[model samples]
Target: MRFATVLAVPATILGAASAATTVPVTYEPKYDNGNFSLLGTACSDGQNGLVTKHYDTAGSLPSFPNVGGAFTVSGWNSSDCGSCYQLTWQNNSIYITAIDVTQQGFNIALAAMNNLTGNLAVQLGRVSASYDPADGSKCGF
Candidate 1:
């Protein structure tokens, strides 16, 4: 009887081990392959006359514009207060850069779109000092 008990213990242990799910974890928890693209769109807070550009993409990591291969251009946050955002990439990497308003003009145009606010543009050191759009000389604005 004692001999049978010993055999039963080992057999039970072996059965449990073999019965475990045959999942492919690779010690990696999960697996992923990279390939990607981005789609950009512009949205406006029309009531406030503010336009925002949005970029969204799925695919993999190596296809971003001007960003390089393997080294992903994903995952980013702008530390520049007022203007900030975060980006995530499949390669588990990150890159952060300023959103140049001058190039897109979305942000600047939003500010100018409101006729009421356009009046204030002259005071915020805009178009040089004293809000003189026609002044040939720089007012250190």
Candidate 2:
């Protein structure tokens, strides 16, 4: 499956996006058409479920939760079908704070505001991909 990444940076005087060590995140990959899996050969096991990829290992996201879902990426908020954010943190060690998210699909959407702190990064609690009929590509984070 094609993967996108968002980063959150904390521990600094002000929130800044910095480089950090890599971590693997796992989730299911769905096509924009809403039917079948975008699960690529990279994602080999279905019964085992999807695999978590390193941010450096993937693409960009729509939002960045402040420091560990505590804050937003500098100046960004939720915008459905909008762009994604790469939230990250820094200090002794850099890591993922949280994924600030937006996209449209299914019956549920991410509409909660979080204020987290510490940790370089945190994996997404969950995700739902909606099928875009025109282009037929994945566009949800």
Candidate 2 matches the true fold with a TM-score of 0.17
- The list of candidate 1 runs beyond 4 A from truth reads 1-76, 84-107, 110-126, 129-141
On lDDT, the candidate that comes out on top is 2
The model with the greatest TM-score is: 2
User: Ten-residue segment with the worst summed lDDT in candidate 1?
Assistant: 23-32
The estimated TM-scores of all candidates read 0.15, 0.17
Candidate 2: count the clashes.
31
lDDT of 1 at 94: 22
lDDT of 2 by residue, 12-82 (tens): 83533332322222222221112222133222223321222322212222222111221221223222122
Candidate 1 local Cα displacement, residue 107, angstroms: 5.8
lDDT of each: 0.21, 0.24
**Cα lDDT for residue 61, candidate 2:** 26
